[model samples]
Target chain A: MKKSLFIAAVAAALLMSGCSQKKPEVDMTKQETTETTAPAATEVDTGVNSVVGTEESAGEITTLPEDERMAKIKELEASAKKIYFDFDKYNIRPDQEPRVDEDAQLFASDAAKDLTIKIEGNCDEWGTDEYNYALGLRRAKTVRDALAIKGIEESRMVMVSYGESNPVCTEHTRECWAKNRRVEFELLP
Target chain B: MRFFLILFMGVALFASDATLEIVKSTDNRPSVAIQDASEFGNIRIRQKFFRLVMGDLKVTAHFKVDDRYRESDYDAMIDPLLKDKDYLFRYRFREDGEQRLYLDAKVLDLSSGSPVFERSYRVANRARYPFLIHRAVIDFNDYLQMPSVEWMRRYVVFSQYGKPKSADIIVADYTLTYRKKIISGGLNIFPKWADKNQRGIYYTKLGNRPVLYYYNIYTGEERRVITSDGMLVCSDVSRDGKKLLLTMAPDGQPDIYRYDIETGKRERLTFYSGIDVSAQFTGSERKIVFVSDRLGYPNIFVKRVGDRAVQQLVYHGKNNNACSVHGKYVIYTSRESDNAFSSNTFNLYLVSTESDYIRRLTASGINQFPKFSPDGESVIYIKHYASQSALGIIRLNYNEGFLFPLKGHKIQSIDW
Candidate 1:
């Protein structure tokens, strides 16, 4: 009985915030009924609110409903972070071809046409600075070339090389080094 | 007259006390022996610590590391000699952690069999253990009768990785101890100290727009100096800090250019259509040593200011990527093998400016970014191992080598 009262309070607070658009009234009504039947209803609502808060803070989310366009953009951003490279090499790995294809498809889609994507190429700290810088440029160019080949215009995509400047992990192990050498994509309006 | 003589005697006694005379000269390097204490749990850890200390001393080229002592023989040899003569230096590791290390060392005068200097050095937990050892070595050297070079205690500038597309400029001791991030928030690379004072560093920050940025090490103030369309990297700064030698590719081909910091005027130094980069100033501001591919292969070239005539300094290697200049000596990296995949053994070579005398300083591994010590007797370069990278120091006169493996991540570029 107490859990039901807590769920109703949270549901009321979320509706009163008036921050989230698109069916807040409907979600509040659904929560009012589910709060009585399910014990996990409050937990689910909290998770949804946290995700919504993150998107709202990023300021990239628009008033679009949950549709295929937004889904494709998220899928592409996930694929963008999946860039892989060969061992001790900065060139794009052959195994990452499918992910590159997926990224290219997202860039060509109508929703992503106006978005600016910045691809940052990086390398393992195994070589000299000048060599790594050149190698990083090659990696970024390879991805940019893939996008161009897939019908994405060149103007929408920009490429830069961080060389070996940024490493996600500070460990000296091989696994960390492999992860260090990659290309990441950031989307901008 | 008698009272004046007494006063003169008093003055003479004080003057004699102020002067120190070395009655004996030892031609040999200072001998040091290290043994693991039984109380320390692991013998391997003790041995590793001893090796690190010995390596640090050997690289300084001032101490003669004696490996004649062992942990098992400590009871029979070191214990008896602990009170005897000829024990120049002694060290032992007490505590070890993932980031912190404790070391206790003692120095003795062999002739008198008396302890001269003793101290315990501790460093924060850092990935580079050899650096902690290096600091201990520096202290040991300073405690000795003579210290070789004072610059051993200076901070080393290099890049460390935090993420796949993120590397920050870091300042650390020669042994990579006491590391602090000086530049981050973007991809920062090729960190070079703007001057010997170590007040500022210039590095390339690769973001949406690639630009060369200058960062004050103390205040954390950063300013964008210049922006380029394709590539931009600051190779070296003049000793006086008035000019910077940069490799920029604003017109599509990378070339060397001289930029005056005071006037904001950039003069194209090299008009080559091919790649001409990595320009380092000689002792005098009139000449520069840079790497160029005008001969269809990357090699070191030297040219005087206001002179169109360029002289090739190195003709032995195919891909001599980087170089540093000190006085008349030029140390450069040369590719030893032609096979692309087979780890092209890159070694360092030292050559004279006036003659064709080329001396190989390093024989194996991928060594690059060779910088001369302020005294010009030593050269510090980056040594690439199969798994890690190290800051290697070579004493030219002593023919001794020392290396401090970098902890944290791989080092991109370093300047003393």
Candidate 2:
């Protein structure tokens, strides 16, 4: 059983590397600032595994006949944390860095060695669609770079911006807006 | 006849910007009144038809339209009350079957007591009655040899936000009386007409990867154009529909890119580290005008194609975030208040690329997404005030404005 899981893991890694090789390469060294030439890719399909609706309850994961590794992956995703930001700002607050660090540690663990991470950035409904989308992207990018610094492979991550369209809270309050301006984590296979 | 001949000649002499100056100086618009001659139809719908026609005339800024309702036969003598007006407009409306509508309209010169023009219009769907009126109005405006109010005949496409993670792209007439859903069932936004004919549209669907889709309206065919990791929005289509100005963030940073439809090649236009988006082709496609946050807040900037040089277009506001251009004039939305958390009074301003001359088009409310009509004589923008959203139009030549309130829904963006 251990041998089979090891072979599966290695094959997944090789497949991910093969897919990433087809994408236009981004020079990490040159991306330290703005005005760099961006790579144009026709499509970027990260992966198709979503653990959102897998387990109805935390207690149910232990009884499933799935691989122990898949069970552990579900457990990790169930505890995935969200990091919030200030109004009209994308910079991850100093207080939220700890959550980012914790999330980064889970993705780095052996249980999630072959899974992809999808980072979703959202914003409060306060700005124009074009500006809000860009801001949301900035928020997601900041989180992605932070995770990269914390040892998460860049090729295993994908980012998407929901702009002001996906709000968790509909109330018109400052606290609700703050809750809406957040970066969420999703695990993909 | 003599008066209209002189007016038509005046319109020819002064086409666009100069026409506004001439109208302001002369203030000599012909007076016209609309009379409902519908023998049978829904009373409310008949009233709506009259109001829409009057609205179309007023929007033209080429006539003084009477607001009071008057009824007369299509071939009857002009009403005495309408005699004071230079022209008496009459229309007959009826429903045949299954909501089929027919309209026979005529404009009579009250001074001469003879018909100046007459035409019959029909629509298979009663819900689409507004277009028939719009077409008639455009025809009348053309008959007078006035500058084309052709923009009125074009459909206004927009996206209305629903539940979280849900928005639907809708196309409607200028008055918003005619609306049909084009795209739905996900967070789809930024619906832009793909060409001058508006046969297709470009919109973005948000998901694990932001995908931009080009949908043809007539055939209901959809083709996925491109997908980006961070964000992707088709901001503007080139005048010829062969190239597109796209806001795509490949490295998690947003910038403007020009994409060619034929070659599938995208050339990065703006390479700022900060946000650069909402680009519109300007100066006959020689340059592009876009909104960028180079100064830590959104402002308008213009860059020549194939050149790395950039120039700031508007120096008036800190948050001049959205803009649309036609010929030499650019219309943009500027935030007047500093509050970013709540609704701010964002007004529209018109500026000329030829000189430093500036004109304020809107005075109050959260006015954004200012799109210049194809003719550049009018502007249509989204307005939010007092928790209510409305579609607003400004007849630039006449300095007159009109609002058509959208009830129970929030407008995400709009374009023509």
True contacts kept of 2: 0.81
Per-prediction DockQ comes to: 0.16, 0.47
Chain A TM-score values, per prediction: 0.57, 0.62
Model 2 chain A TM-score equals 0.62
Q: Give lDDT tens digits, candidate 2, residues B309-398.
A: 899988898778778888788888887867754565688888877777678876767888788888777888888887787778888877
* Residue A81 accuracy (lDDT) in model 2: 86
Report the lDDT tens digits of candidate 2 across residue range A79-106. 8889999876778799999999998998
Colliding residue pairs in candidate 2: none
lDDT for model 2: 0.84
